[model samples]
Target: MPHPCALDPEQVVEHEYVGLLDPELRERIELWEEELLDAEDASAGPGNYDSYEEYEAAMGGGGPEGDELTYQHDLSIAPGWKVGGFASRHLTDPAPVVCSCGAGMRPLLTVHGREWDSGTLNWVPLEDLDVLRLPGANVPAGVYLGRGLMCVFVCPADPAHPHRLSFQ
Candidate 1:
């Protein structure tokens, strides 16, 4: 996908956060997390990928860890997960993002620098820090969301349409 026109903070529009759920929401999310952790396998799971040699062993030889260490980011949206938040990138349009199809855009993804910023357990596993910090890892080919929320937006009219990425 192509990047949006390079825009200044003043040039682009903005939006406010409006999805603060009730206190019960946090309890539900915690319950869900516990269930998920219990249901998943010990080794064959997120943030726990075997090496090439281990993969080869799992295929035909004895399965075990290998020299290379591979990891996957934990998808569990921890307690801090919020909705309808501002962009978090150091440099990017704020909000009120618009689509090329002449329609208002909505958020598709909110890429935070950390699963838990502070004052709580770091839900983001240390093993996945590299993936989170790497520029363009979650954004477009050239665009960078910096160390904040890289909120990716999509056209509400059509899901297949191109997306718009912005940082706050």
Candidate 2:
């Protein structure tokens, strides 16, 4: 079926930054990634921790510090190509993508240029682990949109409503 609204191509404004060079922020991100990987590992195998409390006890008993909201946001949004999931706020703070019809929009599609990066290795499929060392393996599709992702949001109130696009 054809989409209800026509999308016009427009130039996207770019912002400059020093990249993820902040030592403290970088450390937090790295720690979060490690924790994710560890949690995945613990849950995947048999005879591992039976509960979150046990897992926390096994590892040191402390949650993320300094910018807890960002850590929680990262956990809420799944990386890579996804449909019908929470939009990632990696580049910007959480904001609602509202429709002109006064309805809240939800993420309909999220396109990612790379399946996994240095900090998101846990997202890689187990079968693809063998090719981790291969160049371009992480980015099967060479579609790079702005910083890395482009999300499309649609209003639940009406499918015919215009979809909103966000880049991060």
Candidate 3:
């Protein structure tokens, strides 16, 4: 057997990492990508002519209704996913939390979630969102505006994973 302190002759030194990422982080990222790809592939239909970018855009409501969808926050996505929307750190009661970056947090004007397991759909107004925190979301992720509604993006852990806090 080789000596405990001595290195194996064929072992690599592990001196070079592509960046700050360690193997575990890399593995998580890979796994997440794999899940996203699988989910996308399975959901895609022949001659659908829709792309994820288009889907993402539609999900954000940037497109007119009836266009290719980006997937609604209440449909294929989980809760707490951050989406592009108007946000401000300072706010009124129940929320008004401070961001880790020291920016004030805004309220979630709106929210959505799809429970694929139960085939349930959800769409909450701003008043109710003062509580729920979804995954992989930043503080801005939770904040919403305009009739107190915000779009829900899928948790980054996996496109199909359960909702997480959007804002940190």
| Best candidate (score: lDDT) | 2
TM-score of 1: 0.33
Could you say which candidate leads in TM-score? 2
lDDT of 3 by residue, 1-168 (tens): 211221112211111122224768667655766676566556554424367677554344323332232222223223332233332211222243344444544333324222111222243324334533453212233334443334333333344443323321
111-168, model 1: which lDDT tens digit per residue?
5543443322234345445665465433322333454456678788997889987655
Q: What are the models' TM-scores?
A: 0.33, 0.57, 0.21
* Residue 70 CA displacement from its true place in model 1, Å: 39
Query: Taking the tens digit of each residue's C-alpha lDDT, what string does model 2 give over 39-124?
Result: 75574456477788776654544243211223433334556666776777778866778999999898898888776664545455
Each candidate's root-mean-square deviation in Å?
13.9, 13.7, 21.0
> Which consecutive 10 residues in model 3 have the weakest lDDT in total?
6-15
The positional error of residue 125 in candidate 2, measured at the CA in angstroms, is 1.3
